[model samples]
Target: MQGDVGFAQQILSLNLVPRKRLSSCGNDTSLCDFSEMWYGVILWTAVSSLIFHLPAALLALFTLRRHKVARFMPIAILLMGIIGPLTGGVLTSAAIAGVYKAAGKTMISLEALVFGVGQSFCIFVISFLRILATL
Candidate 1:
């Protein structure tokens, strides 16, 4: 019985001992594979962007037709429709791509980069027009 207790204690101690100097290398098996996660995040982002922007686009169109707030109302509506969706899509894509890079993945896909750039450009143009409208 004493020998059995000692063996149990030894096993418990071994299990409880903290591991030191965890490896920083990519070989760690515990880390989640982010590839699928990235794809899901990007897809959801695109879908949500479309859903959110659809209603906003409709509202902008209605406002442009009814209120006649400014001569550049068409431009504003276009910006809201195109730029808003593009911005949201790109931001989400970039975030996923960034995670891919952080995970020591060697290949960064071009699709995400293109999406991000297109979205950023749309945002820039939208902001410019908004400023112009204000002026």
Candidate 2:
């Protein structure tokens, strides 16, 4: 949940369009201005959601065999969960850059996405540590 919060905060803080542009668009009757922004956001949400769950998905598939691998499952999950997002940061940043670049966007910073990805990873590790501690 906390990892999700970091991601949400990161995405929410992004200004898809400058307030000046948004104000002008608001005055216009056409929805194109705001619609474009929502499109970018939706793209980000979709990519992030898929990337974040990748580790879990992989673990589930591997664990289904329930053989020798079962003994190392916990360690594998922990390592993969940690490493997955670390690698994801680069991919996320690149994807975000591509989307914004295509949009000719100047308002939003890709750095925010990078930071958000990092924070999400931190939150993931922290949450996992907390869970492990409780046990």
Candidate 3:
């Protein structure tokens, strides 16, 4: 009877341990899932921006001779196209980093911010130039 009781207690303890462990693991997984979701959103936004910007930038570059105002317009547009995106990208990356850090999340790193800025800047410049070209 004594041995049986001891075995039962051991079994109960083992069961309890696994439950706690499982819960902790589940919480970690939840965090990871949220991080992945946020990252996905960022990626989608960046990709969409790129898709929209490409043709616009090309058009702007190609249409410089179409208008009487475009001779000087291309240079101004080119500068804005480059500078606007650069500034916007920097601002965006800084904002993302600040927000994620404030949220106490570990997934948002400096490297991610750098990557995001590069992607955003490229998209912005392309789109801006494209729109300007049409003008």
Winning candidate number (TM-score): 3
Candidate 2, residues 15-34: lDDT per residue as tens digits?
Answer: 55333344443332222333
lDDT of each: 0.49, 0.51, 0.48
**Regions more than 4 Å wrong, model 3:** 1-54, 66-68, 108-135
Lowest summed lDDT window (length 10), candidate 1:
11-20
TM-score of each: 0.34, 0.34, 0.36
Judging by TM-score, tell me the better candidate of 2 and 3.
3
Give the Cα error of residue 97 in candidate 2, in Å.
18
lDDT digits (tens) for residues 1-135 of candidate 3:
555566534532332111222332234322222334245335434544455455655677687666677656545645554564456654554466456557766442233434554666667677669989999
The whole-model C-alpha lDDT of candidate 1 against the native structure comes to 0.49
Candidate 1: clashing residue pairs, number: 0
Off by over 4 Å in 1: 1-35, 66-88, 91-94, 97-135
Candidate 2 C-alpha error for residue 58, in Å? 2.4
RMSD of 3: 17.1
